[model samples]
Target: MPDPTATQALGRFVAGSDWRDIPAALRHEAKRSILNHVGCALGTARDPAVQAALRVMRGLGGAPAATVFGQGARLDPMGAAFVNAVASNLLDYDDTHLDTVIHPAAPVAPPLFALAEQRGLPGAAVLHAFLLGGEVACRIGNAVSPGHYARGWHITSTCGAFGAAAGCAGLLGLSAEQVAHAIGIASSEAAGTVENLPNAAKNVSVGNAARHGILAAMFAAEGYDAAPAAIEGPLGWARAAGDAADVAAITEGLGTRWEIGRNTYKPYPAGIVFHAVIDACLELRARLDAPPEAIAAVTVAGDALLLARGDRAVRNARDSRVSIHHSAALGLLRGRAGVADFEQPAVDDPALAGFRAKVTAALDAALPRGAARVTVRLANGREEETTVLTPRGSEARPLTDAELEAKYHENAALGGCADRAAAQIAAIWGLEEAADLGHLTALLA
Candidate 1:
């Protein structure tokens, strides 16, 4: 059975957390996370998926209470949160917590941004709430870890709802009891399966997480209640979603060890597991003496998780993002794996398609999750190989603040917001000091 007190314990911790209590380092990390999320959302502002979402939200419009990032349109808090969350995650480039593989900011930050913009709240409050929410999400993700995700649940959408609710609850000033109820409500609403990871359907679930999270908090504010042990009851979220919950993972490091600190931003726009494959392939490409056409075969070696997530047939851009073959081809043929490398045109490129057919995946039990070894055989009978245990964007080799800013600039330019990128960056950096988010929201719009 799950721990009976876990839900309430988490609620109490978030309810009582103070901005002053957070370490400076953690506070700065929160800003970094926010920056990355906004940049990702902006980067895809013009994507068809994001455009479709905006149209649907606009059609089902409510009060124009919040600004949609990179668009001039405003939506209700829930609508805005949902749309913004979709944008942040569409590129698969948001911040990741390596342990749980939860893209924390995509589902957590959108609601906080919506609430802050709608209520004219202070930026400090939003950041604090985001920190609390992301911590809750990652911790809950920890409780379910490999099992929850392996059982077909999308960790980001399923656990992300709880984070969104917790942040909204904190922002709404819900008491400990109310916060617990919010978490309970979130358990009933949270859902997203790994089965839909390949297409637009996956993004819808992510949007639902952000929207429903705010709904959970709103209901809690109205004195709505849920069973005290809703999260760990006989048939609770953990057991229902995964084999069992690691209750201690939830209760162990409440405030002392912030999970947000462990969050890492992505340098490549593909699945984190594929970063190692790209890195290894890039290294091999640099040493190759033969031309691209001379390559006979390429082998990618990684743990079972890597193969399970990445070994696939590439039919479109979305498929290429998680395909082992595509990543190898991009690194070996193009020498880079930027956003353009994963697009449909790139996926359909004659040379890249040919190279992809030459690439194959192999099991490597000794290699850890996010590590890869790639070997290439040339027509001349010569071979080149490389292994990357720690990819560029992993926790051990996180992107620096400047690199993150540069990434933001690149994304902003892609989304057609390059002109205002500098001001947006400045606004986000100075977010904690601002009394209100009016300037940021305006700039975002």
Candidate 2:
């Protein structure tokens, strides 16, 4: 029997739906997501990992197929897409869809931007392809959720490949059959490991996915062949990788429901899973008037998953972004975590080390996935406890538009875009009329 879910998803994506077809509120939300992603990419470009990747890409430079955002360098379509994707995710600051547990923008933006530059696509076309790609990535993520991730598969790379294929197919103007084949080819090539967690290599997974997806679409457009039911057939993606396949989730309300709008933006530059604990710690810090010296010890209690299964690289500044313990300690000592929060001095600060050493973390089986309780012990021997159910950047308590813009600007400036990259990206993203993608690329340059 054929896998109907993959067929239905591929069909809806190939139909070329407009962003206007989605609710006005949802469209605004989608715009916010794009802004958040661009902002993070701008900041991420400055990271050593991204710079290293760019240096390597420059060494292997080919025909000028696409423009790399921050470096002002051109590369072949696949090469540009890969490096740009790496830059966007190097800091782990991109927006994430919780249900699917995948960072949608990491894969979607690279291919869309690269193809737009290569083909001179308009802003409206770019936005449309972006939203469609996000939808595909999220649905595929939902189809394999928790299970695929549990099996040591990185969803950003595995599920992201399909998302990249969808985005590229839309940009390339492929037919439904061709798009399906692109997805099929993507499924076969999709791969990323969870073992690289919290390392720069984790970011590379998104880049690889974007590049592979673009290549798959380009090949399919040139009459390449792949399994039609690669997602749902025997030995398909769902069967081979997914834990509990939610076929209905992938197809239900396909055209009317917009999963892209459902994505949540991160206010802090850390893993989404640690947000709840960070919120709890920050709240505790704000409530106490005493200086850091006043605090004797801090204990954070949360779901066992965070303490045990959380990424281990977070013990140092480079790995701390994915470490629940590190984020919790940083939130209590510094009030927030950002790109600057992970610097060597900040990570090695005696004050932070003192707080970090005083902090004890444990898993609470009773706590929910996003719930966290933090207890602070003052020098006076008084303990204050607070429990947080949702983080500030979560859907339950999202960041305001102003906050999102500010974050974008901060990040963009860090990527050496002091001269209007943020404003230019926002202007192009909001344009109703068809504007050349060059305007946006120029801002990056």
- Write down the lDDT of every candidate, Cα atoms only: 0.92, 0.77
Write one digit per residue (lDDT tens) for candidate 1, span 124-226. 9999999999999999999888988888999999999999999999998899999999999999999998989997889999999999889999999999998
How much does candidate 1 score in TM-score? 0.98
- TM-score, every prediction: 0.98, 0.93
Tens digits of per-residue lDDT, candidate 2, 1-445, equal 7554574466455555655676777656767777887778778777787778877777776777788877777888778888888877777688888766688888887888888888877777777777777888888888787778878888888989988898888777888778888888898888887877656777677788998888888998999978866887777877888554677777777767877777888887877777887888888888987787788887778875566555343356656676665776778778878778876677777777666777778778898766778898998998899998878888788888889888878887898886786566667556446566776677776
Q: Report how far off residue 59 is in candidate 1 (Å).
A: 1.3
| Residue pairs of candidate 2 with colliding backbone atoms | 313-319, 314-319, 314-320
Cα lDDT of model 1 overall? 0.92
After superposition, which runs of candidate 1 have C-alpha atoms over 4 Å from their true positions? 1-4
Error of 1 at 416 (Å): 0.7
lDDT of 2: 0.77
Q: Please, what's the RMSD in Å of model 2?
A: 2.2
Q: In model 2, what is the error at residue 98, expressed in angstroms?
A: 1.4
